[model samples]
Target: MRKRGVKSVLDVATGTGFHSVRLLEAGFDAVSADGSADMLAMAFENGMKNGDHILRVVQADWRWLNRDVHGEYDAIVCLGNSFTHLFSERDRRKALAEFYAMLKHDGILILDQRNYDAILDRGYSSKHTYYYCGEDVAVEPEYMDEGLCRMRYRFPDKSVYHLNMFPLRKDYTRRLMSDVGFQRIETYGDFQHTYREEQPDFFVHVAEKEYRMEDQEEGSYGGAVSTARSYYNSPDADAFYSSVWGGEDIHVGVYAHPAEPIADASRRTVERMASGLGLTEGSRVLDLGSGFGGSARYLAETFGCFVQALNLSEVENERHRQLNAKRGLTGRIEVVDGSFESVPFPDSSVDVVWSQDAFLHSGNRLRVLEEIRRVLRPGGRLVFTDPMAADGTDLSALQPILDRIHLDDMGSPGFYTRELIRLGFVPTEHEDSPGGFEDLRAQLVTHYGRVLEETERQEAEGLGAKVSSDYLTQMKKGLTHWVDGGEGRRLTWGIFRFTLSEG
Candidate 1:
């Protein structure tokens, strides 16, 4: 909750006041509310008993909660399998709507449900671990169906209590949250991210009300863009890439020799792409997905062009700004924290758009192309290199790589050529023929292989404390997949240069 910036919370299902009291103890401003006055009374007493704590209690029905409870909160927690108590779909929807209305714009709703699917599909069983941990007491589902799950609880004193609950399936619950305008819903099994479907006794869902790019349709690549932003912003990623690929260049290198330094080879690829741009002093260039502003600095120094280094990672952008200041190129380079999918610049604002091995990270390659076209002046150059899947290659064969990158597909050479032309871009002088960079399919096995070797060497010499062994292992596996894919002609990497149509 602290990590997510939650400072105030509403415990909508305070139950015996356990959660609400805990929230107050944890230094969060919390309000406890329950539909039943008895529950609220007991919760207030429990709060007092816990630590002389005073809990602000409210008697409110979920459907019209705001009528009694006022003020929005950063988060609202409906826990202890309380949501299933609403038998009708209309009631559930109404309650969720009320919760949505009672939250700040960036607020979150944390709801939990019993794993009724397991009770219905497989028989009811409990490890007595997560919930209902009382010894000499047994709780089981006496009767269960798609609509109803009747639970029976027996105490040590031979007393029994029964409750009927709506059997909410995991996917159905997620769908309900989505339908209620929750932009993002993340579910955890017994508070664990990695758990079998039927293993968890409860499923906790954290739904965010704020709009995010990843909430877009699957093909939009919003999820992939979000993943890339998070990955690059991570400390380990920043450290590893900065150390291995050199502090400046983090993209794939076009090696003249297998033994060439990674930074030099990478700069060579950047130089090759820039050669066709015809950039001049004061020319405005936008470097999309610029990682550390290495290429931006080079363009500023070599061609005297002003560059906007647009990237999604704040960590990388901070480093980029620091480097620009160090090299006295801060005046020439402006680091903008943004995604290429939605360029934060005005239309036709740039003389050239430059990217290297970055477009593959986009889920919606076509949208990126459109954005490039929108931002480039007529006859402005677009130079980029992406690690692409070979044309007509089966995507199923690249599942491992795709899973690692959180993308559905990679753009092929054919796809780019068609998209560029469709988006009013004409091949530049750098094109080998009208088909553009067809023969520019450079192999990446050597690049990834060299990276892996250098990474391992750096780790062995104790130069990479931030890079964990698990990260290294995953990196090695991912790099091997790329290497094998390259060797089998499943992947292609190279530079492409084009000019926005003047007409």
Candidate 2:
């Protein structure tokens, strides 16, 4: 989403500062505020520099958004729809009231909403795309329809970022603004300015706070999510995993917890990515969507290169820091907190933009490739993989259910290739590894057996709390989906190796 380049920007609910940092990169006098201390720390570190262009990150909630601001700004943006996280109508209004109070009366307020209709149609899983920084990403946006959209982001390090968004209908939001004292409301299908009826790629609200507040409640407005004493470290640690693929286990790739013994399955996938990437000594690279930063670390230590890994998760950053430091290669790997839609580095910054299976989390795929092209020097190589639909299977019936858990911006493989070519990269190589999803079926046999064995051990020690109910549910759904045809056979992994042709 693009902004009108306002001089001053207060990024409300700046989770991990991904959007906030981008504002700085886009040349705004930006300051980010969020309720989460952990999130603020991540953004503060990323935006810590002086001058008017310098970023100042604050710890504040959406409801108290105006209180934290001593004066008004030219613009205020509540992206990631950080508003939808509200669980009820009252909270939504409360947040909106704060948003209104923070604006300079005529200043613009832009926020986004997940297109519910789109989610009910696509199911979670995008045709994966390769990106910078030895990482690849894909999405399975989850829709609870409880007015919430759960976005699942899988990274190259096998780590995950679950974005829990509460989506409100455009009509409902329009009225909410009217009632909450915001006039001049304009709706777009995202920042692209597509109409709402078109259900454009995304739903965005561009509204102005009314100068007259006589009829409105005189109170605070934009306080977002609060990071209390205890934070939910795992987005779905207890999730049952029963999504649109419902009651079926669909394994697109193999991932073993870093704590777990390296499965033979995990090893094979890693080898494929590493080998296909064609890494050589003294390689200099940028890694995007670098979940746990393992792939970036691998490139630095194994290939003797300097690698920069970027991710949005504070928890994952902590883990990656440990991994990089333990191997005595912390100096070789620089982990930044930001998003690939807008990488923080300058033009032509590296020799290789290595991303593997981590770009899927992006809301826009074309912009991702364009950004990659903007950062790479002439002739720099881009290597990555994405698990995607082999064909546009007529998944209309099951599509809605599946997509609710995944968003539409998650483009297909064909969609990805077309965009890459459209973005001006020379066509290099396109290949798919089939049946990898099939081989994953055994995970039920293996992962289940391990769980059962653990249960027995616990029981022997006089304990009965066995497998988590959600874990069992997810595995069952995954198993059922894998052996089925609707979404399974269509599932496949693609490896892309492209070159940035000399200008």
Candidate 3:
């Protein structure tokens, strides 16, 4: 194997520091981060023997990788069941997401998956008793609230022993990385890395994915696709978003746009309302009218949750589809097309129905609400934010305001709640946005500054210059209406969180 001008490497889930020592010995700058303190300490000691400034190791979870630790690696390695340790489908994808987020554009994610044929319901000595330094190391079944799993540990000379064995079918892990935007994702074996399934000890694999500008596209989500026209007719939409958010990777727009950052705010609000809504790890969520795919990503990543991100625009779905692919979150983040009225999801498919500020575009509010109820698992949550009438009044007044503001928007708080209850969905929570769009209007504009000057230069071009004005104008008036309106300023924004009945 050629060294190939590679300089640094990040060893994820690095146990015992063996990889770090080997890299340091080979004169590479190795930075290792792991969740196990005991394992990391061993890595530290092992590195120490090779002189003072050897390796940098930190204790961290692979699911939410540290920004400082990722990026620019010749190799970003996760071996054993490190990739499979994510507790759930959501966690698995989140781990892949963070891993992709941190790795340098051209880096490799080398990890192994449990070859079911080599382990589960296979293996000659069904109960092979093994000895590691004279301590017993066994792999067996154990069930927790989470799921079924296997654990193996060696005692006495124990350093980083207990193997937290997570068995993921080979195809499962393979599809996961592929969907997560790994361009050249492939499987290999120990040392030789042959794809053969004859090995019983363990499987060795490596995934090398190239990062390039051509991978960027408009309205692409979690790496999924849609029709061509739905994408914004950007002379350079991808470039513009990339300049602000700072990545050529899949979700450059996620951390790029200001409204998207609301994902964090949404997370905060939902977490507070979580107790009332009764959502546990098993909950299935629906992100109605999913935008650039940030919230769906957040719900899946932060809550160890699953979300069906339904949207109308091909562009929006495309953006989210790709983002999911990049983050390895496709399993937990499903991007469905068609508006709320036409959702094809089977009845009782969801436990929590959530929408951010994107619900205003739908036409039939009652049928939409009814569709939500039909799809919700009993007692499932129906939570979202909408422009509410400042004072309980005619739906007429709200229509004009929403018209100037744009989209098929209009629904007073009274009308919305009544519709929810009418549909048999328990209206769990609702409130007028305290600040309305007034605060966000300013915040959104401020967020448009160029992180990369090329973005500024490009936006300055002739046709592109006027593109953002309309969106900004609509936002400004919308905010002014709610902010400066008299005592009962009729329109306001709000957030909601709720649950589905276990029955």
Candidate 4:
């Protein structure tokens, strides 16, 4: 609490004023609140006895907390596993909404729950260490199902008490907190940073109301952003990509010639995607997964459009900002360090959304598309390209390629078209494609082959020494898999254009 700058706290589940009195002694303005009047009364008495402190107490139901308890708090502490008592989803949501309403704009909610995941998955087992450490007491589950965890607590006196809880799973609780508008949530196991999922006796969640861009979670969509960020920010990756892909554009290209320079062919791809967008001066463009701001700079410079370059790599974003500044496009191109899965822009705010060979990195391509749909204005254009699996190809055959990218599946042309139509995006006409702007598929074997040869040449010339031998070997293997996949008709790559439905 002190680290988070919390001075005023609302102990919402102050069982016996244990936390409220402690907070007061620790130089905090503490208010004790509980749904039970008896609990609040006991808490008040305990507060006075513990520290001669008068804990301002409120007897209020959690679902209607603000109806009785007024004033916002810098922090709300709902400990003691009290939240699991709410058996209904409606009650849980209402209570969480009340907690959110009672918190300041930058306030935080620290809540804890028993590790019902472990108890339900594997039978109940605990060292009796952290939360219930009393040597004379024993706690075990009396009954457990998907919904209920009835615990039997036997004290030193041989007296037994039972607790009926809703058995909230870790991920489910996290999702509820997120659904209730908590922007960032960090869960700790047994109050420790390093603990296995099934090992923890309790999970403490610190949910922040404020949204910090730098502290965004890897998200439930498959941890792709985190993986990509780590990979691209590495020294070898930066050095190798900068050397081979011309530092500006790292995506696959539209090869005009078999031996075309990687940078030129990549620029042609950007041009092809942008040609049908009808971009005008000052048009707003969002470049998702914008690597090194290559597409962003091109779109901004050529069409005089303002581009928001959203990417996960700080290393790449820094380089992108530097390039934007160098080319006097800083005002036109804004580099944002973020994931495309959760774009930090308002709904219907952009005229165009652009990406290239990037959506393949998303664990949840559907979520990425939904975010794109959210940010794009009515009638806005979405033009981009990605490396995809060929329709009807057995995904098992692509395991080598999948292992290289750490993905289970790749989006296909069929998947994109179906999803785009479902998301209210109408396919626009493109002159180069035969299938009415739907089928612009191209095999990337030539592009990858060219890159591999150039990289080898660069290595022979000692210009690529910064790239480790192991990395080069892995790159060779990965590129070979891609080439084989492309040649075998198991992979496809191409540009897709869609317009948000005006209706």
Candidate 5:
């Protein structure tokens, strides 16, 4: 990507030369390379049709890519599920190492493949989101096993073509990428930053050759051994949020009015709370539990502030990077993959500490607050919204909500005020929005029903449905409990504002 400082590119598997030509048009110095001379000839012809006389076109196999393709490049593009063509592990490793050898020290490699795990584990059909986007072109796997996946392609005129490919598992490909000396490799599902790993038709891996400096590992918390670690680290966390929230912004949306868009309301809530913090250009902000970094983006774009987002989920953090790049706000927002308990920042560093409904995950709420206080500069503001229990509620009545979030207890406004006072924070204001809960609850039920209906329709039309049964079952239960005629007591939502008093 341009954001990653890529100025020169090599289209490694330049089949038909689509990517190479596009890169050339985008002002990047691009060279096209392919294993087959026939493919290179076709690619050159295609480039010529687009008024491009490709400067370099080389015929080279991937295993010895560097030998044939001279000179290093800032980036290498190996797309269109071409990597699976290498059937053996030695060939795969050699091809990857050659790719590494061809890249600049700080170069990057972008590669894509079929979601073969879906094909090998659970029978999956292509939705044509990535590879076969043209109408009248059908692509499907006719035969699949642990190693080989034979695909059948049907053209418009009923012309058929078949190709045999190794079914590379997602994890296996990632490990290969890393083992081949790529310092960082970020994977995406069907060009989306957030998705269930099992549901996507294709996976894109962007491997970086730059060596990233390691962060300090000493005195960390809530990792591996922590209960909160297990909750956030599980694959279900990514699946649940990505499927239900249905967007890059993976937090609770506050719908002030039914007619208003949920996303708009969510942004409004962020802006409202952010305004109270007095953020301005160049202000340093810390976002706690920054899920998919929705609020961090909002802060950076709206106020021109630098936001450091701390989160526990690596999946969400990866999504955050993609979203930030897409918005061209990557420079303003930095995502840290860590727990909030230790706050991986120096004291008195941030001007504002912002969070949204993420504090209850802490088994040690007091320690979290203490870390927040330690990180804030004197007089820095703390603004956050949290879901809490209603006053005079029966403890037994809150079990379902607790079970839903895997929390032992929900924090109340009173509880937060007491804790803030103990930490020497001045509790400035609190806004109770009970209706927000009702609105979100209704929206969840409606969204679930819509998803189910669409899935059923797709199934009837002989399309593969990617919906998870467990997610639907849980939603139905929650909807039954929280609706107007539900048995469980309603939960409360509140926005709290605090400022650290200079000691």
Candidate 6:
């Protein structure tokens, strides 16, 4: 408070008035508030006894903090794990907005919450520290679930109280604070700057309200590189995919020949890839970067295999869930929201790891390969296709294509072979599907261009267009580059089959 020049401070959740009384004794102008009138009254009494002054106490809801609290302050302290009281994302965002509105230009907001992710992911055993603060009082979880952690508190008199709190993940809270316009957020675990994630019983996030430019690196193709946040997670991407290619699988297809239909080619690719691995009933499959789970559901339906499809996009995850339910394949295919870089399962848990045109999106190919290797059971197969650069190709020639997908560059078959062998995997099959890129690019150009024209005509009649013309423009450039197949810039589409060593 002294360093930040904080004079007047607002304790947003001044439970029992302990912090307010301490602030008053420390000679700082303290204003305390709580959502519960009873708690505020108790805090007021506690303040009178401790400091012989009636603490400025108010009963106010955090969502409408500005409406009840009159003026902005130099600092706002929302401590004591009070933030988890908000169960809904909407409420959390609204409360954070209100908090931001009630702060000085350079004021700081300190909020603390339990590391619910640690409790949920690993069983919780309290360090038995200063929480509750009184030896006579006892606190423990009575009921716990992913969304809610209902804690039971026992008073010295044997009376009981319960607090229903939403289990907020640390990273999620930081992301929410960022989304709510916090310029800078510094997090400390158990009041220390450095600690293991699981070791922390509580996390304190001090967010500053200041204007800071977004950090991004310039790319070769006049775009931001991997350092930039993904637009793939945005609603615009979802809206484009939902409208333009609604209900259609959005991925590259395998051309059995030069003139196969894109949809048929997609199914044929999955079938051919599955056939190489002898995918059959009861096999457990893992699909990384599973876009809307098209191939997962197809494999599950055809081979009766159980597939866990992991993807990073929430929009696609929800869509996949709904689609799976509608198609009666929910039992066979489980859609998980995650990244392939950190496969959220035990090692040696899957029989096959499948992907299609998705590996290019991952910048760290070695980490991706390591994760793929870890999740595969002994003798498990990895069958997937990715866009690769031809050997001895100049990567500078494909900056346009790389920028369109937010990638550094494409990987080659030799690169995959070397990485797989180093990771104790044998490359069993290396097939460069002949003319796959040329045929797929041509069909996409024809089909997407026609859709763009039809949608433009419909928009002229006051109907809605599903895709933006900007997408079409980018698609045209990329497709033209592939069709042009310039000497060093041509994309080589190849399928890789690898088996983990039984030893």
Q: Considering every candidate listed, which one attains the maximal lDDT?
A: 1
Q: In candidate 3, what are the lDDT values of residues 1-503, reduced to their tens digit?
A: 13445677788877887777777777777788889889988878877865654567788886667654645666777864567666578888878877777666667777865444344433323223221233354444443212434554445555444545456755457567766777544444334333222343434445556643332432232212211122221212332333333332211111234434423434443444343455556879887777567767767777778888887654446767998899999998888876676567899888888775545544456666777878988866776665455446554555645555343446555566556655554534434332111112322222222222333444455323322333333434544444433224545544544444354
lDDT per residue as tens, model 5, 1-503: 78978888999998888888888888899999999999999999999899756548999988888778799999999998899998999999999999998989989999999877667655867776566748877778888888788988899888999999998877678779878888556677787755654488888888888754333322364422144543454344566555445355554445565445445656666767776566799699999989888889888998899999998776778878998999999889999988788888999999999888788777667778899999999998888776566555664677776666656676666677788888998865434323211213443333333444433444455322343344345555654443421223345555778889898
Q: Write the per-residue lDDT of candidate 2 for residues 1-503, one digit (tens) a residue.
A: 24444688888878877788788887777878888989887776656542223457778877777666567777888876567788789878888888777777568888776555445433332212211123366566654564568877789888988977775655567668767887556655445432312324456777766453322321211011011000111222111211211111211224464223223443344455556455666667888766566567657767787888866544456667877888898999898866676677899887788665556545455667887998888888776665444457555534542443243433455676677666666655535433211223333334334433433444355321222223334444544442343234444445566778786
Error of 2 at 200 (Å): 41
Residue 418 CA error for candidate 5 (Å)?
0.7
Model 5, residue pairs in steric clash:
none
Q: Give the lowest summed-lDDT range of ten residues in model 6.
A: 216-225
Candidate 1 residue lDDT tens string, 119-149: 6655687776789847877888888888989
lDDT of 4: 0.83
Candidate 4 lands at a TM-score of 0.58
lDDT per prediction?
0.83, 0.57, 0.55, 0.83, 0.73, 0.72
Regions of candidate 1 where Cα sits further than 4 Å from its true position: 1-52, 55-221, 431-434, 438-442
Kindly provide the TM-score of model 3 when superposed on the true structure, using C-alpha atoms. Answer: 0.41
Q: In order, what is each prediction's RMSD in angstroms? A: 10.8, 18.8, 22.6, 13.8, 11.4, 16.2
Q: How many residue pairs clash in each candidate?
A: 1, 56, 43, 0, 0, 0
- Candidate 1 lDDT score at position 374: 93
For residue 302, model 2's alpha carbon misses the true position, in angstroms, by 1.7
User: What ranking of all candidate models by TM-score puts the best one first?
Assistant: 1, 4, 5, 6, 2, 3
In candidate 6, what are the lDDT values of residues 367-444, reduced to their tens digit? Answer: 789989898998998877776776667888877777666667788766777888889887654353331112233433
TM-score for predicted model 2 compared with the true structure: 0.45
RMSD of 3: 22.6
- Choose 2 or 6, whichever is better by TM-score: 6
Better of 1 and 2 by lDDT: 1
